[model samples]
Every structure is written in C-alpha cells, then in structure tokens.
Target: MSLLDDDAFPDMDSVSRDRVAPYIIRTEKRKAIDANGKPLFRPRRTQMAQVAWETRHHLQQLLYEAVTDYVREGYTTRPCARRNATSVF
Candidate 1:
C-alpha cells in the first residue's frame, strides 16, 4: 500500500499530522486568503531527496567558507590543515 494511504495504517494519522503541522497551522491561521475566505494555497508534497541534497550542498558551502576563513586568519599555520581545508571544496 502507498504511504499516503492513511486507511492502511490508522497510526499514520498522528505521524503525518506532526510531519505536516506547519502547513496545517498556516492554513488554519488564515494568513493568506482570497476574497471568499478560502485559503490562498495548499502545501506541496515534500521532495525528501531534493531537500536532503540542497541542505547538504548549503552546509558544505558554509563549512568550506568557515575553514577558508580560519586558514586565512592564521588560526592554524600547519601545512596539513591548510591542505585539508582546500580539499573541502
């Protein structure tokens, strides 16, 4: 059965509720609504793999910048540390 098939597993309701809580809360808050009082939007399905990849890429960039700054600021003068920092890219 598909994971989204809530009827297959009743316990999934609570699990899914927690997972999509942000979207549900936003909808309930009426932050964005049309003239008729309906919500202006619905939440899109989460792309787990894409999200994971983007998060990894962003974190890697942050780490690389931090290491580069450390080396540039002379926080560590060891040749090995300098070489290792450059390899992060």
Candidate 2:
C-alpha cells in the first residue's frame, strides 16, 4: 500500500512524523549509521528548522506559480468600479 494511503498508516498524521517517516523506516531496516558506519543521533533543532523553512518556501513558490499561471491564461477577472470621482447623478 502507498504511504499516502491514510488507511494503511493512520498514525502518520503529525508533521513531525511525516518528516521523519523515511528515516524511521530506513533505520528499522538497517543499522542507523553515518557514512563511516558510526552511530548517529536524532537531528538537531536547527536542522529541523532548516527543513521546515525549506518546505514552507517551496510551498509558497508553488502557490505563486499557480497564481501567475492563472493570470497568464487570462482566467483572472477584476470587478468593474461602480462609481467614479467625477460622476454626478
């Protein structure tokens, strides 16, 4: 089953869990070690912050791209002004 299938993995709801799922699965299948086969510890706070920042930045870029695409496609519309400064009725 796919990891995105919530029914297959109900506990993968939290942001932290989603971020660490790949590492957790890899460690479970093999020894957690560095390139030199040395043991590794949990990621530091700064590392997690960097990951979060990158994720947020990527999402913002995607949203901006989608908006620009819509505008370029001429799908965006602006409402007409109901009144003008010089108009007198």
Among the numbered candidates, top lDDT falls to 1
Give the range of the ten consecutive residues with the poorest summed lDDT in model 2. 80-89
Which residue ranges in model 1 land beyond 4 Å of their true spot?
1-56, 76-89
In candidate 1, which residue pairs clash? Answer: none
- True lDDT of residue 22, candidate 2: 54
> Candidate 2 has what TM-score?
0.23
Q: Mind giving the per-residue lDDT tens digits that candidate 2 earns over 17-89?
A: 4444554544442357889977676644553343334665988878878889877654534322212211211
- Give the range of the ten consecutive residues with the poorest summed lDDT in model 1: 12-21
lDDT of each: 0.57, 0.50
lDDT of 1 by residue, 1-89 (tens): 13654554456224443444443434454367889978787855765563334665988878878889987876657766655445321
